[model samples]
Target: MPQKQIYALPNIVSPANPVIFNPDICNGCNTCVEVCQIDVFIPNPEKGKPPVILHPDECWYGGCCVNHCPLPGAISFNWPVQQRAYWKDKATGKVLRDSQ
Candidate 1:
């Protein structure tokens, strides 16, 4: 019988939350916490305080929290570099990076 080797992916750590909250702009409504499907945000101890990101890695990047926010520019999400979309033109057959 031969032994099998198992390997883990290299150089990957738990990803940081792409979502950011502007404290000044946020009204502490907790809408983001309620909208997040992945349980990413948790309520702050103080009443009427903005929620905090409880599990950054659990976020699915669905944009629900950002869209539901009542205050404009309050919630911002920076998509991870690795998740950037690559678009290919069907007619030209050229590939373009989304961030470009």
Candidate 2:
């Protein structure tokens, strides 16, 4: 038996790219908080939101938040095509995906 590191490369450049936590859909579950290996998210005391990426560069561009998010479109990230940035959810964040 051996311990396997699923996320061996904490800093690996994932195609998932940088993603942001949307305040609207975020239920404050903190699932993303638990998953992130780089301590990317911090609980926002003032807003009572799930958490904030106080240090984004620490983010490995892994869309762990987006993939595990119970709410749709809560986390925004770049996909393979379009070269354009977009949020997976309906609500908008810092980026936008132009309708093609």
Candidate 3:
């Protein structure tokens, strides 16, 4: 008989939160819930309540929620430290990149 080998994986903590919703600014409009491509936000159970982040790990950092939010400064995204820095050049339509 042959013996089977088991592998273990190391756990690493992420430094940034993919999406942050400010309850003070959030109007609970559900715009974020509708705009998220990954379905990260869900409507709160109570009416007129802020949506909840259901799947933070699944967020793609697409900024759809932030772009579509009706309230200013309601949503924000922070890239994980492990990922590279991303920026956009308005003059040439180029995406800028850098290390954290």
Candidate 4:
């Protein structure tokens, strides 16, 4: 019997400001994929999912994903002086602060 080879996935380089995806809210739509200019995500085969963060260090912190998700209270970020940890309109890119 021959043993199957396992491959190692590339690891995220860690961002200066760490951000996380709320799986509860993520529909696995890959909307973030179309928007990201930095190539931060790669498809997850095991999970049958779209782009997962391939390089967190490359994140521009531009809050593009935070603004694009249609699900309310989906994406967010926590940084000093600005805790815009909530979802927003994809068109206007406005965070729903009052709801939070």
Residue pairs clashing in model 3 are: none
What is the Cα root-mean-square deviation between model 4 and the actual structure? 10.8
What does candidate 2's lDDT look like per residue over 1-100, in tens digits?
8997676556643433356567788877777777877877777675647576666656665777778777887766644454555655546445546544
Query: Which pairs clash in model 4?
Result: none
How do the predictions measure up, each by TM-score? 0.66, 0.53, 0.63, 0.55
- For model 1 the local lDDT of residue 10 reads 71
Give the number of the best model, judged by lDDT.
Answer: 1
Give stretches of model 1 more than 4 Å off.
1-13, 85-100
Collision count for each candidate, in order = 0, 1, 0, 0
Mind giving the per-residue lDDT tens digits that candidate 3 earns over 1-100? Answer: 7977956856533443676778889878999899889898789987677787777778888899999888988877767766766899999999978643
Arranged by TM-score with the best first, the candidates are 1, 3, 4, 2
Worst 10 residues of 1 by lDDT: 9-18
Better of 2 and 4 by TM-score: 4
Pairs clashing in candidate 2?
73-89
CA lDDT, every prediction?
0.82, 0.66, 0.79, 0.62
lDDT by residue (1-100, candidate 4, tens digit) is: 8999978966535443334667777666766766777766665554634347767767777777667867655456645335445678899997676332
Model 2 regions more than 4 Å off: 1-17, 78-100
- lDDT tens digits, residue span 9-69, model 1: 6754457656778878887888888888888989887777678777887888989999989
